[model samples]
Target: MRTTFDFSPLFRSSIGFDRMLNALETASRIETVDNWPPYDIAKTSEDDYRISMAVAGFAQDELDITQEQNMLMVSGQKAGEDKGEYLHRGIAGRAFQRRFELADHVKVVGASLVNGLLTIDLKREIPEEMKPRRIEIAADKAMPKGATKKIEGEKHAA
Candidate 1:
């Protein structure tokens, strides 16, 4: 089945860069291969998020996490053993690569492996100026009369 996406309307508006929308489209069109590792993404807070991948047989030294150009990549590669002869190989200890598109201003805090699970934490840091703030209007400022000078918008044309 073919799917269509009309993003012309979004481009016309001031919505800015549609990174999330693009990510959705990319994810939908991605082809699944044999080397797909199980993973989970969880939102810890308004600005905090965590991504965990199941790497049972992979060691800590074999896993690597890096952020490049707004993209988070996780890869793992198990070293081949020369001394052991595998009678039966059921568990997959092969190399795998996973990519995740990150939104603007999103940063990777850190990553750690514990109990056969690799956990990576991310945080979105919004500057104080970018955050929402309330503008308080003084009672005196609201009143137009008895003011030292007329405000720019206060004066009306006759």
Candidate 2:
């Protein structure tokens, strides 16, 4: 069952949150039954993240990881089918695909497959202009360099 949330009220009162609201909406509509090839997401640091997936029986060459814009996709394809007949089969070696949504400015730095775990590293690097800065509060007569001033409903460069 899928639950729908009404964000019209927030859209009417809020600004610059359309992207966040869209993400929530998209997440809510995702199917809950496609949980194969279990994975874990961890925040390694304030701006660093790690995604570890249990991709056993898959080799590095058989897996593909791609990042386009803010979306990341991971997929695996088995090379050949097993020839031996087993009484009990536990390990799964089937082709699978998984996707992950990345935040703005978050980039995939590296990835490694060790043992049966596939680890992906990510880091968020904010641009210099986007970082917070302290603004100087000048006196009435004091004006900062390259500042703009308004006079008679017209903006004047100062």
Candidate 3:
């Protein structure tokens, strides 16, 4: 049986968190997802990330990687069926498509396939406007250095 979660309560008080809430809800809905061609996500640096996937028996031409919006898709398909027969076939040669949700500002840098491992590099580049900046507070406009002051109770001549 599949279970669903309600996020209506969080929607009322949360501001600018629609993406996070949606991702959480989406994850909850996919309870019995496939784990084919296992993969790992690792943080290489403060803003650098890497996704390594085991894709044995798959050639570079048979794999496709794409990014649209905040979603990254990686898929593999064998070119053709093997004509030779084997007494015991253990290696799995199946077509699979895996999707990953990426956070804002996260972009794919490069991808490589070496020794049956498909590694994808990513970098999070925060825009200049979004980065933290110190605001300069003016010191009350310096009070006009030579300005004259008058008493509150005294009257001024026109």
Candidate 4:
């Protein structure tokens, strides 16, 4: 069963959130999205994250990781090889692509393929201008030398 929602009403009132809403709509419409190459997203620290995917038969050279804006894409393509004889092919060796929507300042730090697991590390490094800052309120008596001088009210011709 598939459920549909009307986001037109939200679009009317919200501004600059079209991308977010579009992402949500895309997620909702993807009913048959494949869950191939199982993955896990973990928060290793306050600003650090890790995404680990199980790539049993894939090698580091066969995988590609890219970041475009706030989206992270990880794809794997099994290298072409001759499969001679196989009685029972149980382990699924298939190509897959996975995408992750990251927050504003999130960035990909590094990635590593170890023991059939491809782990990608991420860190959120907020810009100095965006980070919370403490404003120092100036006291009336302690004003700076040039700033202390006040001018009388004067009218200017427009």
Candidate 5:
């Protein structure tokens, strides 16, 4: 099946280059791979996010995490150990690679391995100018005759 995205409106709007690049990067990465060593993305707060990946049989030293060009790459490689005898082996101790696309202003806070799961935290700090702000309008302004205020399709005439 083929999917289509209509981003014409966004391109015509005031979206910046960084945002456009980030969006395109995300779309491109989505077509690159499927779920492997399955993971979860959770939003802890308005500015914090957590990504947890199942990495059983892989030690903390065998994993690598890096952030490059707004992308987070996590990889794991397990070393073969000498064994006297083994009847059957079912656990996965092979190599795996995972990539995550991060938006602009997103930063990796830290990473930790617990109970065979690697958790990476990220935080996005929106600048003061980028945050949403409410503008307080003065109620003392005298409206001229036939003046009207339109808000969300509601028109109030004075």
Candidate 6:
């Protein structure tokens, strides 16, 4: 079954969200999803994340990881080799490409491949200027010099 939604209405009013809307449109139109090379996503800390993928038989040289803007792409291609004899081929040794959409300020910190597992680490680092700040209100300086002065012709009631 396939489901599609028209997002042209949103594009008419929204600004600077072309990538996000396009991603949604693309996702909705994908009829057959390829879930090859199982993967896992985990939040290790408040601002840290980890993405681990099972990529057996693929060496580190054969894998490519790239981060562009808010998108993370991980692809793997097995080096060419001869398959002399094989009675049963169960383990997947195929090429695959995976993508992940990340929030703003999220960045790839590190990556490692160990025991047929490819792990990618990410951290969200908010800029100092963009972080929440506390503003100090002036108690006296805010008042005008003559704000509290009584009128020259006015008589004091007290």
TM per model? Answer: 0.73, 0.77, 0.84, 0.86, 0.65, 0.84
Model 4 off-target regions past 4 Å? 142-158
Model 5 misplaced regions, further than 4 Å: 3-33, 81-86, 132-158
Compared with the true structure, all predictions reach lDDT values of 0.84, 0.91, 0.94, 0.89, 0.84, 0.92
What are the RMSDs of all candidates, in order?
5.6, 7.7, 4.0, 4.6, 10.2, 6.0
Per-residue lDDT of 1-158 in model 6, one digit per residue for the tens?
Answer: 55579999999999999988998998888777799889999999999999999998899999999999999999998889656698888888888999899999999999999999999999999999999999998776566766785567867898
lDDT, candidate 4, 1-158, per-residue tens: 67898788889999999988988888878877688889999999999999999989888899999999998999988789646798888777777889899888899999999999999999999999988999998876667767756688988999
Ranking by lDDT: 3, 6, 2, 4, 5, 1
Instruction: Kindly indicate the candidate among 1 and 3 with the higher lDDT.
Output: 3
Best by lDDT: 3
Span of 10 residues, lowest total lDDT, candidate 1: 141-150
lDDT of 5 by residue, 98-132 (tens): 88878878999999999999999999988899989
The residue-by-residue lDDT of candidate 1 on 1-158, one tens digit each, is: 66767665766773756776677667667665544689899999999999998899888889889899799999998877646789998777878999888887899999999988999999999888988999997675365667676457666789
Evaluate candidate 4 by giving its C-alpha RMSD to the native, one decimal. Answer: 4.6
Measured with C-alpha atoms, the lDDT of residue 82 in candidate 2 is: 88
The better candidate by TM-score, 4 or 6, is: 4
What is the lDDT, from 0 to 100, of the residue 26 in candidate 6?
83
TM-score between model 3 and native: 0.84
* Candidate 2, poorest ten consecutive residues by summed lDDT: 27-36
What alpha-carbon RMSD in Å does predicted model 3 have with respect to the real structure?
4.0
Residue 118 alpha-carbon offset, candidate 2, angstroms: 0.4
* TM-score ranking, high to low: 4, 3, 6, 2, 1, 5
In candidate 3, what residue range of length 10 has the lowest lDDT sum?
A: 137-146
Better lDDT candidate (3, 5): 3
